[model samples]
Target: MYNVDDVVMYGTFGICKITAVEKRNFTGEEQEYFVLRHVNSDKNVFYVPTDNEAALSKLHSVCSKSDVDALISHMNSEKLIWIDNDAKRKEEYSRIIKEADYHEIIMLIKTLYLRRKELGAAGKKLRSSDENYLNLAENMLFEEFAYALDIERREVVDYIEKHIA
Candidate 1:
């Protein structure tokens, strides 16, 4: 039950604002929908059904600076046990992205970062699949943090680095 102007992280779209909530009789049925506009985009609007729990669950409240600080504090100790099997790892990555849990996303980023470093040290490159998820996770995290912290998206990496123990 979000009100107008309330900011929330809407799945991969990152932070968005609830601009309106109304019942519309589309498809010959009246149902409530939350009209959302992306905080960073001027023209993107999303109409999400109010009662769709799966979709609704994707809408998470933007984390505060304190929350980000807490996440950073735990970053070093968070264990990201890598799944060596390609198929299994992909499936796990998909679940993490879909779930979009802040801590899990951080773990994904940290895991991939460490993996990339290890590969580089061994004269190898990160696998394409890993690279793709790494970028996605970073994008999701940076967008939300930037919006909540009132900073540019490019600053998130350095910001988190400063906070990480």
Candidate 2:
């Protein structure tokens, strides 16, 4: 059971702080739920079902320096080939973001960066959906790394820029 003030990851909700854990009467039975406030949003709270599988299995931290290193390494790999179908590509990217893997997030960031550069070279720009996915993946990875390293998220970005650029 998580205590109040514990930082945890929630499915699709990203990182949150467990502000409260209280027992309440649910249909005449005692039940416990976590009151979680999103780390990145203002005044956003979630009542997380204590028994929800995804919530229970949520990652508390990246923990391993190797994970961050691996992510950086993967980001430097050859860019992915652009998918011809926009809808399919968006779906695949969404799935990759939701998986919340550090390496996958890095790959997404790398792919989108390359895509943006290529588009710029061709006198084009990224579509709104592509921009959203890139921001989401970058934010997710940054938050996880910052939490794990007990550093500011901006610091993570700076570190990545300095080391991985």
Candidate 3:
């Protein structure tokens, strides 16, 4: 359970600050909801149910700088098992992304970069689905990384490159 002003990661919304924990009835029952606002954007606000396990599962911790560094160090070892069939790959990768694990997300980004490079060499491009997944994964990972590491989101790629190179 997070308290007010606690920053957390939520699915594709990335870094969010818990603004309040109040009982609101958007549905029908007056149930408790965690009110959150996007850290980067005031326009985006979310009210997440306190009792919904699945929704709450998407609410995750924002790593500290040291923790982020540790995760970056592990980037080399974390990798996705490549599925050759597009449909299978999409299904498997989607599940992996939705899991919201940092290690797995780093792996996903690496895998997509490699695959995109391979396809480029062959005069092809990443499928639309793959591209969308890549964008989503990058956004989620980098937002938390930027907030935690105290760096601009655009600097994340360069930071990773310097660390892992």
Model 1 lDDT on a 0 to 1 scale: 0.88
**lDDT tens digits by residue: candidate 1, 1-165:** 778889999988878999989998777999999999998787988888899999898898899988877877888889885889999999999899999988888889989999999999999999999999999999999898887678999998888788873
lDDT of each: 0.88, 0.75, 0.89
Candidate 3's residue-wise lDDT over 113-156, tens digit each? 88999999999999999989899889988988889889999999
How does each model score on TM-score?
0.93, 0.77, 0.96
Global Cα RMSD, each model: 1.4, 3.2, 1.0
Given candidate 3, what's the lDDT at residue 12?
82
lDDT at position 52, candidate 1: 90
**TM-score of candidate 2 against the unseen true structure:** 0.77
Candidate 2: give the clashing pairs.
none
What is the C-alpha local distance difference test score of candidate 2? 0.75
- In Å, residue 112's CA in model 2 sits off its true spot by 0.6
lDDT of 2 by residue, 43-63 (tens): 888776687667566545434
Root-mean-square deviation of candidate 1: 1.4
lDDT, candidate 3, equals 0.89
Residue 97 deviation, candidate 1, in Å? 0.8
> Which scores better on TM-score, 1 or 3?
3
